[model samples]
Target: MRLIDADKALEKISKMIDYCEKDTSVNGLTALFQVGDAIMDCKTVDAGLVKRGKWKFTGTDKNGDVYQCSNCELKIGLDYETNYCPNCGAKMDLEEPE
Candidate 1:
């Protein structure tokens, strides 16, 4: 899955439509429909800061001591540690223990 700016894509597609409108040929009609299909497959880019941080061991709770996501402060269980935060899409890592 790729992300793209929908507004920019739409602007380009609008130009294509304008050109196709002025040429009224079979190729122009085909290009117009192709642009429509492209629009249908487009996905807008997510708007926000791209977060990346490591899990920090904060404090203990009822579920035993847990780590907090540095980006979103979400508490995660030791059993649920992963490469990414479930809540904020932040990439997470842990320091090696000696």
Candidate 2:
């Protein structure tokens, strides 16, 4: 699923309702008004669960190359870089110097 700015969408819907009101030929605008009200009553979603982070290369060892997670500083060896951190569940999608 995808997220969108509810307020902006509501504004557009409100504009459409106003336009419908001004134009007598336009019909079936009750649903548009209901959509705006529904948006106002909807709950907001945040990015709290999607913790952003990046993996920094620390060094190499006899075992293999090492990298550290920026968010939790959890260290791991090479070829183990997953999308999310194992320790803190931070998504390793940050664009920075590796």
Task: Compose the digit string of candidate 1's lDDT tens values, residues 5-25.
Answer: 788778878877787778777
Which ranges of candidate 2 are over 4 A from the true structure?
A: 1-26, 44-49
Where model 1 places Cα greater than 4 Å from the true spot, the runs are: 1-49, 94-98
The candidate 1 region of ten consecutive residues with least summed lDDT is 89-98
**Residue range with the least summed lDDT across 10 consecutive positions in model 2:** 40-49
Candidate lDDT scores, in order, read: 0.77, 0.79
Per-candidate TM-scores read 0.40, 0.57
The digit string of per-residue lDDT tens for model 2 on 1-98 reads 44557787677678767877798776576656566565765556554567989989999989998999999998899687789888899988999666
Please give the TM-score that candidate 2 achieves against the real structure.
0.57
